[model samples]
Target: MDELIKYAKENRRLLHQVPEVGFTEYITTYLIYERLSQTNFNLYVGDDALDIDRQVGLPSDDVMANTYQRALDYGVPCSFLEKLHPYKTGVVATIDTNQKGPHVVLRFDIDALPIKESNEIEHVPFKEGFQSKHDGEMHACGHDAHAAIGISVATYIDEHIDELTGKYTIIFQNSEEGVRGAASYAKKGWLDDADYFLSGHVGTISEEVGTVGATATNFLASTKFNVELFGQSSHAGSNPQDGNNALLAASAIALSLNTIAPHREGATRLNVGILQAGQGRNIIPDYAKLECESRGETTQLNEYMFERAKEIIENGAKMYGCESKITVEGFAPSATCSKEMIDIVKSATVSNDAVKTIVDEVSMDASEDAAVFINIVQENNGKATYLIFPYHLKYGHHHPSFDVDEAVLEVAITTFINILNELK
Candidate 1:
């Protein structure tokens, strides 16, 4: 591997070893900030930059404390975390040359999944000794590499700001796995005043190394929610009749939610991933919690499903003489990529023949919070598109064996730089 590729790969491994989930990406954030902090670009992190009100799916205090201490053990400076103290995490750095041109924003997600990684001797990371150190958390997604690319772009532009016109903004977003984070920045006006906005996800649609998804299609809208059911606790054997079992309420709600009618006009989905409640076999549980989500091809369709979900959860709780509390954690809006933005990405990739194919469009039925940024930017008369950069993947995203060829990081860095310069 060339020096540049090797550098990027090393950075990815370092980040991969310290995987964090959602808004608690202190270790990942520090690495990027450390690499780009030396540049003249103005940097923003945490509370001031990310709207705390809009941030969702954050870890509990105990979990956040453990991760923060781990980040310190991993060599992240205490002074650094102190700067972002009041908030969890987010990143926005701007490089301005005082030239007259469109303001361009480049975004990248930097977070991991809550999955225990494989420890087999044959696994590349395990063999190479850069595997995740945190149990039950791993960089099953390519966000580690994406953060490296974001730093690379920041470094390159900071060095060449004199050669370029216009202002460039780089965002190292947090908690993208559950479609959270982007809205926090957007609602705070962090993405406003953009002439163009662009983002890329590596190896998602197809694993062909030379292909690039210039424009994504069929993006779905979704909502993530958390519910808690409350009931009176009592001894099972002696006071069974006096108990209102929250577990029963939560279980019934989960079943009813899955049976909600699908939208005839478009696709609709409901899933309840987590259900927790109970004290012991001999005691009637008074509390139960659930994590659930709904999705649809369009925003309206998703709204339709969400309404029914609330009803089911509420009525189901009432059936068991319990009360339900539901909170909407995150939301993603369906949207289509702009043709003009795709044209710019296509133009950038076509310059290199090694890029065998540049697809103008590809369907991404999976919901993405980035769509919120795209839609808001477009609404303000700015152009935007989500680029799907491909690579050869050993396993599907979010799997225990998930891994990608590191060689694609260089291509991503170069393509992003070229696109930033070409967005006129």
Candidate 2:
């Protein structure tokens, strides 16, 4: 465990140095494949043989083509990889034990956010010299850590493959931030035979160093929306009223959305992240657009709030005499942890004395596509649990300065290895 921790600390520092964003994580994926292939595990990449018959929502061929190219460029063993519809780059590797036992699936999401790296010297990326090449795109979230930890776990399991006694599948998923990746995976029945499934995030909310929290148990379900308002265009000075004023309608809709927030009780959240309208001040704006999200701890509450939001937008557009279009970009169902699975993870953490604290409460407001795995598992009568590991961070997620303590990476590696052993 001590050696593994040390290795993880060093590797995590290197991963932090080179940040990649979302599905285009080329260098990051290459590094992961390079490291994992060195172990005894059988590796496969590029979804070429996936049972599309089981796929839920089908993505375009162009998306899948780009995904395959990325995987191939990264050196993932793609010859045996399965292809599935709707998933651009979903890679699955199975560790078959040959012995009879329940199958388990573990998922790790490898994607970065769109934020520039902080220039601070103390910030890990700045010091490491692998900061993002693409401006405004960085691994501000701890996804680099997630990918590294996934590799570490796979390596550990591969090293002790002979002693393991069940089917273990490691899924390296892409595009979790868009929240559409996991749903596509689920629709394809990727986890149809699993007895237990697990996924997690690191450094989500503030907690003591090495702490592991059962976050998904209380996480909120969420929906992403893109709203477009259209109106007739006319000269602002000569006939402002005749233009219909789509910008005005968008502004009114944004303000009225605040009213929907307080209507839901108990930890409801809503935010309008992006709003764009108009080209010139002299011209009456003919079109306006908004990207918004809403969430709640339960599906029913989330849906209720979402409905109210729709009503607000509809009435606001009517009042402004503009046409409104609402499109759902993505959606993730709520997550609830299984008591039995939670006990397994908790016991592993306690046995190692890895962290200073282990939080039992739900602690994250941000949504996760990992929640999709929980939904699929439960629907298939299987159990799933998602956990969080706390790494001391100087800045919050999505911030350019966001950085994590490298030492915590060791704790996560140790915890994951122990859990895999115990579960086996």
Tell me each candidate's TM-score.
Answer: 0.95, 0.87
How far is 103's C-alpha from truth in model 2 (Å)? 1.5
Model 1 over residues 1-424: C-alpha lDDT tens digits? Answer: 1454566788899989988888788888888887777899788887666878877776788887877888788888898888655345768899887988889888899999999999988778998899999899999988999888887778778877878888888888988888888888887786789888888888885567778788888888999999999999999999899999999999999999998887789999889999999989999999999999999999999999999999999999999999999988888999877898777877876776546678888888799888988998899988888888788777889888887677678777777877876763
Candidate 2 per-residue lDDT, tens place, 212-243, comes to 77445667788888899988888989887788
For each candidate, the alpha-carbon lDDT, in order, equals 0.85, 0.72
Per-prediction count of colliding residue pairs? 0, 11
Candidate 2 deviation (Cα RMSD): 3.7
TM-score, candidate number 1: 0.95
The TM-score leader among the candidates is 1
Instruction: Indicate which candidate wins on lDDT.
Output: 1
The RMSD of every model to the true structure, in order and in angstroms, is: 1.8, 3.7
